[model samples]
Target: MALNGCSIWGCAKALQPATSTLSLNSKHDLGKCGKWRRCCSSVVNGVESSFQYADRVQVQITELDDGFHKDLNMLPKPLTANKFSSSRDGTKLCVAYKGLAGAYTEEAALKAYPKCETVPCDDFETSLQAVESGLVDKAVLPIESSEGGSIHHNYDLLLDHKLHIVGEVQLLINHCLLGLTGATKENLKFVLSHPQALVQCEMMLTDLAVTNIGVDDTAAAAKAVSLDGRRNIGAIASSRAAKLYGLHILAEGIQDDDNITRCLILARDPILPETNGSYKTSIVFSLQEGPGVLMKALEVFGLRNINLSKIESRPVKRYPVRLRDDSKYESIKYFDNLFYIDFEASMTNPNAQHALESLQEYTTFIRVLGCYPVDKTDISC
Candidate 1:
């Protein structure tokens, strides 16, 4: 692979697709399974389709360059001008989400914007790019899950693009164990689904004592299991996926716990939230190397009585490692990370303005990801 530009796709070149069957280690009929299947129908036309094709070409990604414009220009011409369907008039909102029609991301997208036209994307980057290129009005991103923790890749993607986080939606996941029409738990040998879903259903799968295989998307997993036509091969997905792929639900609500996935809404332009409304502002910042650097940065918020809902740190992509040398100790290396915080206060609040102003003194770099109204609606149903 050649290191050309900063785009993750540009850093590598495509190799020929492998024709060999993927082997699974299990006591059951693992040898009967074939190669992994990609769901191309999930893709739309235009640049996103080009991105999907490009993603297939390259598997390994190296250091990403600073710009995505050069990579965007390398793609082939779009199949059609209107990538989304024509039936959706200009009045309707078009939103992009990663994975097949029955995937959880699509569910979250619809929950956030009920009437929006949901566009299925092959990958997270494609979904983000779709919004960046004006192919869709907004893109819904799964940021954190109550069961599996944070989706770190999307946090990096947030910094990579110029898009703004406009809002958020939380979805209660109800994972189901699905199989062929006549397939049952006793005959099933292995279960397949997204890695997160697999983890969520760990206890249930362990009880069944079947081999677990991780796929890209839950809906795609259901589709693959249905397409494989093997009674032994089952999938852990949503009830909707079972219906969509013509698979039978062997078990329902099979998740180990009550899991909730919080998805972020992204747009090309930022939304101005009303000051009086309940809002949560998200910001990312890097502090100078010091013992109390992070603590001091947080003190500003605490002083203003601004409640922080969440805080997470991600390693700086470009500068991951930093050398630390102190007079008392030998030279050491530490991960240089950027902290992401979600505070329960609107950006329009005067207290928030003062907090941020005070925060600037302690931070080397800072950027507000978004300030949007909180999604307090009960969506557990």
Candidate 2:
């Protein structure tokens, strides 16, 4: 009479079975069982009598109280891919960049994945959106240029979007001052290029009293000069751009620093490469209000021996309420809120996980942007 392992419809005693009969296959049937009805029936006839009734009703019940726990334990854990094997043939890879065919970003993407179909965007933000909307598999955007400092807008965009910086490419930026076939430095009165390009050649531009014009892109400026047949105008761009636009280079290596390089970040879905060297993980978080909060946040990385490559702070736009007793709320500036960071560590390492666990106690928001192999090559032209 003892149905120790028996369960009506394999449900736990804490759970209620269906009021209607549970049909198994076309013919077999498990009679109606309800929590209240079963309980009252059990109390009246005793537990053994209820088991006998269940047997008569032909209802199979699992006796295990931890049925849900056992079922969950039986399920296989999720598996993850850990290698950089090339995607299958006919598998399309979308790469977004802001430039013409021979732009440096495009060149870098081609160098990284020669078979990828490149999508040309008009601006960097557009490139970021292309990847966000799933139009592209990845986007290559410049983060810092050796000669022009950091691209601040892109850094802001990195924080604004939920995209990850999966990998990086360091490309040598060789600036060529290009003009019409017969145009020379002496005849030039105006120079056209992207702001960064113009900054890189500031010294060269100073030597020649040329009016610098800011354009959307260096290659686009070269195309404009070539199309307009500007005999007195020149463009500071790459040699490849001059060739593409049918312009002649009046002078090459015009950038102040001949070894100028730009760091390009490749953004895509979270990619965990199987075999990588010297990995770096980037994370962004904001700390809760308290004294020693910043120090505590930093100690997590320090204790784990994770090198902080770069830490930057941007005001959280949504939260603008400042705590100031004075009437002049605008005058008193306080950088109370900040985006704490950690860098240059592999996620697979236990120390990195422990560091994040430590960080969770103090931080209000935390996100791992990506874990990628470090590109440590001096790509100088």
Best candidate according to lDDT? 1
User: TM-scores of the models, in the given order?
Assistant: 0.74, 0.69
Each prediction's whole-model lDDT (CA): 0.70, 0.60
Candidate 1 deviates by what RMSD?
17.1
What overall lDDT, based on C-alpha atoms, would model 2 receive against the true structure? 0.60
Candidate 1 ranges beyond 4 A from true positions? 1-91, 321-333
Colliding residue pairs in candidate 2: 5-63, 6-61, 7-61, 7-62, 8-61, 82-274, 83-274
lDDT tens digits by residue: candidate 1, 1-381 = 122211111101011111212221222222232221111000122121222342333222122233312222232222122353334456779888888768888889888888887787767888877877777889989899888789899988876776778889989999999988679988888787888788888898889998887777888677667656679889988877676666788999888899999999998777767758898888777675568888999999999899999999987655455555465664544566778999998877778877877786666556667778899989665
Worst 10 residues of 1 by lDDT: 8-17
Q: After superposition, how far is residue 184 of candidate 2 from its true place, in Å?
A: 1.7
Q: Can you write out model 2's per-residue Cα lDDT over 254-365, one digit (the tens) per residue?
A: 8787544444455645666443368777665656556799889888889878889777676644333344333343233345344635487777666776777677667644
lDDT of residue 380 for candidate 2:
46
